[model samples]
Target: MPTYKQFPLADTAEGLTEADILSWHVKPGDTVAVNQIVVEIETAKAAVELPIPWAGVVTELHVEPGQTVEVGTPILTIDVDPDGAAAPAPAATPAPASSAPAEEEEMKPLVGYGSKAVVTQRRARKGAAPAPAPAAAVAAPPAPAPAPAAPRGGYVPLAKPPVRKLAKDLGVDLHALTGTADGGVITREDVERAANGTPVAAPTVDSGTRERRVPIKGVRKMTAAAMVQSAYTAPHVTEFLTIDVTPMMEFREKLKKSREFAGIKVTPLTFAAKAVCLAAKRTPDINAVWDEEAQEIVYKDYVHLGIAAATPRGLIVPKIRDADSMSLKELAESLTQLTETARAGKTTPADMANGTFTISNIGVFGIDTGTPIINPGESAILALGSIRDTPWVVDGELRVRKVMQLSLSFDHRVIDGQQGSEFLADVGALLADPAMAMTY
Candidate 1:
């Protein structure tokens, strides 16, 4: 008997309810082994690859790419006993007892459930026969040509998952364009060019309908909900401070050429991160969370610092766990890795949870400071503005100095105006003078 198994979408993270199918690695009639990656899905936090637990021939894919599915919903089906009794008469013959262990090993349980036993011996196809002799060789009639293979009407374009997703998002037809990459693979630039060349037919001089609509789902939907909740629930208080950071900028340049900080990214954000961690020691309220159900303020000793990153999917904040304990070099490396991972859409839900404080580096966009909403579960958020040279008074005379702005937004319910001001001032002071960290 052929045993058919359905693979459901499991919760990849805690409290995960649903996900969108990003892509499928296998198609119907493809053979797959246990622990083989068969599909990729995008949850609220990150994109995750799912392995099929059964070693079998794929029978069907239940969902298409970009389709959203709830947890426990079947996404694929496989026939674990593809060479079993359902095949030709010879396939029904029982295998020798000695081969049982091999079957068991091939069908080993994964995650929790065990699939059907694997059949090692492949049965011959029905009606298969030896070829006849050629007319020139044996003076007999030539063998008829083999039947043509079934037409593969569904031609999948050669592109990476990210490129495919980008094409889909831009409404670009991948099949219409020629790939310029090696092996004729599609690249991100190819998709963008195609999108740019596409004609827009909806907009006209007479028609008032010119807006495009996109369904809010996945990370974008989750971020929107979080921002709304945090904005309405937490009474936000924002404070701004502009400071001359020439000393810190000079220190950064010196460290970059030094042996201790070689190959490390010691940017203004890195300084801001270290400042926030050190400042939190004196003003712990900046790292605390409000417990609405318990009616108490929860304070944390360790810092899980979150750096706000803007990615193609959406804005995500991945945390550096226990950041306060790390030295300057360690913090720089951690920040570099965190930003890269978040931008690549690989930041897991666990990395985004339990954050103590957040730093939004809006300065990267070349903009000055703006009031930023605090991330959910965190007490305060800081926005770092662009650094530029400005005239500043030193002792008695004016001189050109690197100046930047810092904006801090805090939950007034848990953090008073004084605590917020002190925290912001401490961070600004550290940036204004790197040696101030030694005093902390």
Candidate 2:
């Protein structure tokens, strides 16, 4: 007999109401030892990989990838009784595993673990319309294109199905293409090349006064709620400081060649991230957040620096847990992972929960500086502005320098101007000479 135990999602931290499982590292019936990574979950605070607490076979995958579950929700069931079997019973009639689609086997982490391949089992039938028409009730342009006036040469006709699909994906005007295949059919070569490389400037799509609307739900709904809560509850005060980030820029360039940063996207923001972590260490109060109902402040020893990233979904601040202890290489890797996970819309509510401070890099979008609002539950947020070549005096001589601005926003209730300025100054000093970050 196999004994079963269900694992509930722990409160990765206080007030983390929910989280999304980004991927299941182990699937049902797979054996996992204690401390083995079982799943990667996105919380409001950060993306963290959960370790299985017991050594046992993964009997059931309770939560699907991309499914949002409240804290304490059972995610996986592990069978771990001393006398029980480690593996689950096999299916009655199993199909050959080799038959599985090649695409699914070579999976990328899409939403959660890779999705199962959708098989439309069929075969070619000559003299049949290339594809069943999109149900008659469905509306669309009649011919889809105004077919080329005449056929090009005697290249074998590659059915209309391939031609139409190619046209749709490439946004090509099939009607305008001079077909290279026999009977005026398009070839796969032409379409594949066009789709693979940099997208050709597509012909303007005519909207014809059509209004497109997207419903406010899911991530968007959650973001709106969080923003409303943060904007109204936190008393925001933003301060700006412009600095000549020459040293930081030079340091970044040097680090690029270092082995630690070879795979990471070394940028000005990475230095800003280090600056935030170091400044927080010097003045712990700047990193402290206010406690609302208790009317006291909660000071944190470890800094979880949140990087405010703009994704296709909305604004999400995924934190780098224990930023104070991370080396520059580790920090770069964490930031890289955060941005990639955010764009994939895999950021969970839990990952955004316990951020102590945040850095919003408006610099990526070419903005000089702006007063950024506070991320709720956090005491402060620092914004890094664009790094651009500007006229400056170097050694009392006029020279062009790469300069960037910083904006620090703090909650007035928990942080005062003196404390905020000191924190900002410390951060500026580090950026002005990042090698000094190690001391603070």
Candidate 3:
């Protein structure tokens, strides 16, 4: 009378169709508890861990590692009543009607874990009748409610399995801190904060291998498709400008020592972000979207600034919402947190959605400048070049100054050359002289 339950792959986020199985934590005959992580999956947006809903012994693994499975497909099986009378009834035998109610009540799958449609039982295979329920059924006792403070190394916290793994890797005890997420769930940020900024190491490749082939999926595949669609649909035009940023660099050093800016990271990108916001106000076309279906040009009053970050997974752009309204100190802090979360692979899909403008800092890699592609749904993107000591004329005398290159690429259908030039010039002016922001 052992009751077997198959767990289907769930949709972790909106519009998630399929996922690549990255790894599995449990196997056949292994005992597992409710809410324990059973597998890790990589969707189009981010990596997520799926937790089991039933406390049972694992019976079978439907899929293996590196397999791509669609949502609602059975991935794992568990025997919830392992100590029942005996094995399950065969598919040919029909169980007594009296046992159906107890079996249905005790063996319901956890809600909101699979496809949009609730699956009450396993789908029957082609030309085959469905499996039969056991002749006798026993209802398992309900799991005890979670305690406020779980014992060290024993309590399963109110966090996702991946978050728990992250906490373990960072040497953080989840029991010590309170959850800030909705319904008192512990988030990755809480674990990171408790760990005091402990860095996660990137995966390393074998140095002996001459060549390697990696499957194109996840964020990289999505990025590729978007870039191709953008390049072919949008008419692209790039413009470049070189400017002296000696004044801006000097101002940055001064802000670092000031009481107001203490403990805040003030990088060149922070200044560039502020300049983009200011310049977008002067030339709104740069912060516009070309609506093809609606046949209208959509201009945004608020700015969702996107910073292009290169991480181990791939290139991702996480946005700072309503950045134009924030102060310089606030922008700096947001930029720091955004980049850190992105690099740590903790940025959610919502963080990268609905970006109005994007800025790519090529200078961090010591590159001068290159024409950056316009992000989809965005009209323009700016690239900041390296700051080099170059000889320039200032008030007649030639002197070495901190010089940088600026590149702006825009969709020509939305932004004309004049507007693009004005936006680029405005940003350059602000960076050339930080005091010019007062005029904007």
Give the Å error, residue 31, model 2. Answer: 22
lDDT of each: 0.79, 0.69, 0.81
- What does the lDDT come to for candidate 2? 0.69
**Candidate 2 TM-score, C-alpha based:** 0.55
Q: What CA RMSD would candidate 1 show?
A: 13.1
For model 3, what is the C-alpha lDDT against the true structure? 0.81
**Local accuracy of candidate 1 as per-residue lDDT tens digits, 129-223:** 33222232342212222322443477555665457668978998777766666545677888888888843232233357665556567889889
Query: What total of clashing residue pairs does each candidate reach?
Result: 0, 16, 1
The TM-scores of all predictions, comma-separated, are: 0.74, 0.55, 0.74
Candidate 3 regions off by >4 Å?
A: 29-34, 81-115, 118-210
For candidate 2, the 10 contiguous residues with the lowest summed lDDT are 101-110
lDDT of 1: 0.79
**1-440, model 3: which lDDT tens digit per residue?**
45667677787655878888889999888999999999988778776778898888987776657666777666787777788765544556655655552224333445555334323332233475644454443332212112235356764456654576588789898777676664446778888877886444334557897875666778889889889999999999999999999999999999989999999999899999999999999999999999999999999999999999998878888899999999999999999999889887788877888999999999999999998998899999999999999999999999999999999999999999999999999999999999999999
Candidate 2 or 3, higher lDDT? Answer: 3
Candidate 3: residue 255 Cα off by (Å): 1.2
